[model samples]
Target: MANEKITEEEVESISSFARISLDDDEIEDLVPQLNEILDYFDKIDEADTEGVEPLFGVHGKKNVFRDDDVGESMSQETALQNAEKTEDGYFKSPRVRD
Candidate 1:
């Protein structure tokens, strides 16, 4: 792990790839932190994983969705009955984004 080194150039390249800009101070601070992270990975690589099955996910791949069926849907009037604001039988709200 001591042999692991994170160069400023590599840090600059990584920041550029992420579409973010970092000044000299930030890059200097980040180099040691990045090396520490790599050291942690080196420690993790030392773990004994013998006879351990690879984990994909805790949940299985089986479908858990309910079957879709045609049923009596709510009418427009019924849907908008409790709304504080409605326009042409539709629920109206403030714009979410520009």
Candidate 2:
């Protein structure tokens, strides 16, 4: 067999750190799959990116939010008009805990 990039012991350690319970069969299966994923990352490392500018985000627009201008404020009577239950200018709800 070719050189094993990830051993069974390493898989056990990773599963323990991730708080995951893995049987012997699952650990055996994960060793090869994790090594394959690492190999793909190795291939990606070989890519040429000398002159390429780092892209922070896909969106072209920066700070697309409207101005936070204060407008006309609603009266307290108008705000509590549609409430099913109101107590002293605030909405009242059922008791959450004993």
Candidate 3:
């Protein structure tokens, strides 16, 4: 198996460019965690992929083959009759603030 050597300064430079805005204390805490994540990815890179084809999604997956059937639907007048407010046959909810 091959190994990859990563550095804290490289991670710090990336954090800076991405505007991650981590404080010194937070960056100190995240360094080890990020290194662990990268190590896991390094293991994946060591896998045998030379002859394997890359796939964007799993093969042979469909829409689960649901049966299509016509169903009843409410009329525009019946659908909006119980609202606190209605305009042009549509329900009007309270205005939102932020």
What is the C-alpha lDDT profile of model 2 across 38-60, one tens digit per residue?
A: 88898999999999998877987
For candidate 3, the lDDT comes to 0.75
lDDT of 1 by residue, 1-98 (tens): 35748988999999998878999999999988999998889899999999999887788766678889899999999999999999987899988863
Clashes of each: 0, 0, 0
Weakest lDDT window of 10 consecutive positions for candidate 1: 55-64
The lDDT of each candidate is 0.89, 0.89, 0.75
Report clash pairs, candidate 1. Answer: none
Which parts of model 3 are misplaced by more than 4 Å? Answer: 1-6, 59-98
Ranking by TM-score: 2, 1, 3
Error of 2 at 3 (Å): 4.5
- Please give the distance, in angstroms, between residue 61's alpha carbon in candidate 2 and its true position after superposition: 4.6
Q: Which residue runs of candidate 2 sit more than 4 Å off their true CA positions?
A: 1-3, 61-98
